[model samples]
Target: MLAPLILRGVNFKSGIVQGPLAGYSCAPFRRLVWQHSQPAFCYTEMLPAKQICIEHGAFNRYTSRHPDEVKLCYQLSGCDPKALAEATAIVAAMGADCIDLNVGCPKAKIRKKRHGSALLAYPELLYECLSAMRSATQLPLLAKIRIDGGSNERHNLLVAQAVMAAGVDALVIHGRHWREDYSVPCSWGQVALFKERCKGIPLILNGGISGPKSLHALLHKTGCAHAMVARGSMGRPDWIHYLSGPLEGELGSLSLKQSVRWLKQHLEDLSQLESCETVRLQARSIVPYYAKQLSVDSAHHLVRIIRGSSDFKNLMLSLKKIL
Candidate 1:
């Protein structure tokens, strides 16, 4: 049997959870992830607390979830504790099975909003915000934070202690500092160290875990109870299944033909998506990520897609040549 994974208070007998990615967790894409049998849980793209609080319709647009999606967690980010609480209450009322407060993203736009990892400097505020949410909702809550460099050990410990004290059911620590770029390798050793400090609460290891070797190694090194996969799952929707078991025998990883076929299916189904441009941008944005794995014909298929000449027939024609 595959590993039965659980994180924070969310349990996944499926052993894997799809990591939330901005611009990727829209309804159509999430549907793809949820359809996979291995990914037992899914998270919405991070929504700002203010937006979730005030923009009910738009929040529903981002968070409208599928019935088949098991243990769906909506991740929210913002600096204000009060607004964060308000947003948590609203989403809990709207039927979020779990809620994750995102403090791990390091994007400039998110930082400018005083959200994501930028709030690390305000551990007190993070505690208050989490505590408020805990008081407001019966749903499970997870706090995600980036591990500051190995240098800020003391600060990281303080932050972790506060989060655990605030009654968060889980702590997801991305083993990288806010200042570090993706080019820098994520240190699983740091995750293990943090896990040691957070012995009682569930600690999930995040960052730089793209393949089986890294995933297994990190799980062993960090002693993490669970792992979250992000960029790894993009075009390879079966990434979670691949992680749960080796694919060298059954399907042996997705072929270039299979990838293109999936993309075509995604786009075809997306025609009925609520917003065409949003769906187009998301579908189109993924081409480059899968470009390298593609065969020659598949690569050109992406080029044509980028050129904005996509239709069901054109896409199928491009894919048929490759198949």
Candidate 2:
């Protein structure tokens, strides 16, 4: 059974909530979390609602929850209220514990479609969308928003109030706006205001969270109930546990060889569930995250290892030698 976990008014099986990265939150990635980490809320890659209606098979795959996926969630992006709500209903019936509306994604395609952060400019429409979703299903609804333009504090506050009024169970705030790319910087001060406006709502903060020090600063300053991780958790599977508690003693700083061994095991598991092509892509995806922790040459070697045609066995062997 999924453990009972709650954030503000919304109850989930696990207090942990995984940040939905567009291409990376595949079944194998999510399954890894389900097995190794605490029972946590894991989101599917953002599925456009219209696509959900037309290609139900892909929707099922995107939103599919393993039996172990206790608090699985489907994140939908669209400008149409009815289509969005209808899609949410479909996934809910398919076994989603929560349905999150993606109003924070800043990707070019999503914005041009007027789906993601573009919705922030039309607050009333955003309200209507969430309200439609609220009317359609009893599953917990979450609204993810990036800080609005200009003053982060002001924009986030208004967005929070509107979403809360629309009856979302929780709010996930990315601490940066669409304009502020990841390279700029994060605004912890703005995040600290979340507890002020929506005292009863769970505000999960995202942005610039790379490790323990940042986590500690943000949590203490914001007084938020939970933290959502995005790019940071790519290769470091144990990051959440690492931040939430003390390190795993001697194994805390895993050597490069240890990392290769672990990653090879993860690759094998991924192969069982995904195509070789996908495994290769995912390996490419997480390599940079692991690369950062190693020396420059070792990092370059990791990149080569992921890109090369060697089988998973040879890849691990090569990484072991490089480390």
Candidate 3:
């Protein structure tokens, strides 16, 4: 039997989570995933905790969740405890079902700010941040961390222990060190080792889970409570359904024509929820993901047209012609 993942009394029936993609996991993308894939939960892109605390409208974009996104987790990144606490409170008040601290982002900008994966190097600060956030809300709190800050597995274990000790409800481990790139395979062995020490706290395994086969293998290997999909679900948001099995009334095996129609509907929904500029930018960014499913000529043509056009209607017309 597939065990459900429960965090703070909320039952995640599927145990398949949509990990936050920094620039791409915005409201429109999340809505697209929710409508098509129906992951147990979806996260917003990482928001800067300090900015969300200081700026009046900083969370507007992050908080624009779809009505169906009842299990949304707001992921926050920052080095300050006070700021994190403030931001957590605001996120909870904004109707977030859970809060996640981002400590696994390996981007240069994130590390330079001593946020994201940089926090792994300073266990004390990470604990303080988690503790503050825990005190701020009764909502489930989670920490998403890399396997190791340095090359040492011991560092990873220490960070996991500290995060759990700080009262975090769950841990999401991306099975790689901060210095390791995606080219390096994720170490599910390391995740399993960490899970052994986690006592009863739920552990969600992430990294390189591209499809159902890998997802199942990783789950069996790591004994993780859940699996979180990130880059793998890019153009194929229906991957969640493929991995978790389709929910009742969910469509299966979309044809190329149906996929194109779905893309059109996604763009239309995006336009209604976001500004024109945002719609155009998001459309351009996401269109390339569909290229792989198209013929070589159509793929190249789609990329060219999307890159050159700023108007959504014109872009859609070009896409329709190519599809």
lDDT of each: 0.72, 0.72, 0.79
> For model 2, which pairs clash?
none
Which runs in model 3 stand beyond 4 Å of their true positions?
56-59, 149-153, 246-256, 308-310, 319-323
Residue-level lDDT tens digits of model 1 in 1-323? 23555544456676566778887776656677767646757788998889877885353557776655666878999888888889998888878878889987888998887789877877888888888888888777888888867554446877887788788877777778887876688866666556667777767677786666667777776556577777777777777777777634242545676777767656655555555555556556767666656777767757676555454455446656766
lDDT of 3 by residue, 1-323 (tens): 23577989998777878999877787767777887777778999999998887774344666677775658999999999999999999888888889999998888988999999989888889999999999999999999998853375457767876787899988988888888997678877777666677778888888887666677777777666588888767777777877776223333544556556656766776777677677778777787776665677756766677688868788778658746
The TM-score leader among the candidates is 3
TM-score for candidate 3, residues paired by index: 0.90
Name the runs in model 1 displaced over 4 angstroms: 1-3, 6-10, 57-60, 150-154, 246-253, 305-323
Model 2 C-alpha lDDT per residue in residues 1-323, reported as the tens digit of each score = 11234744555644447788776776656766666565358888998899887876353446555565657778999989999888888888877878899998888888998899989878888988999898889988888888853453346666766787888878888878787887667766776566677777677777776665666667777766577776655666666566555433222665677567656656766677677666777788777766776677777877888889456656656666755
**TM-score for each predicted model, relative to the true structure:** 0.87, 0.83, 0.90
Residue 312 in model 1: lDDT? 48
Q: What is the descending TM-score order?
A: 3, 1, 2
Screening candidate 3 with a backbone cut-off below 3 angstroms (N, C-alpha, C), the clashing residue pairs are none
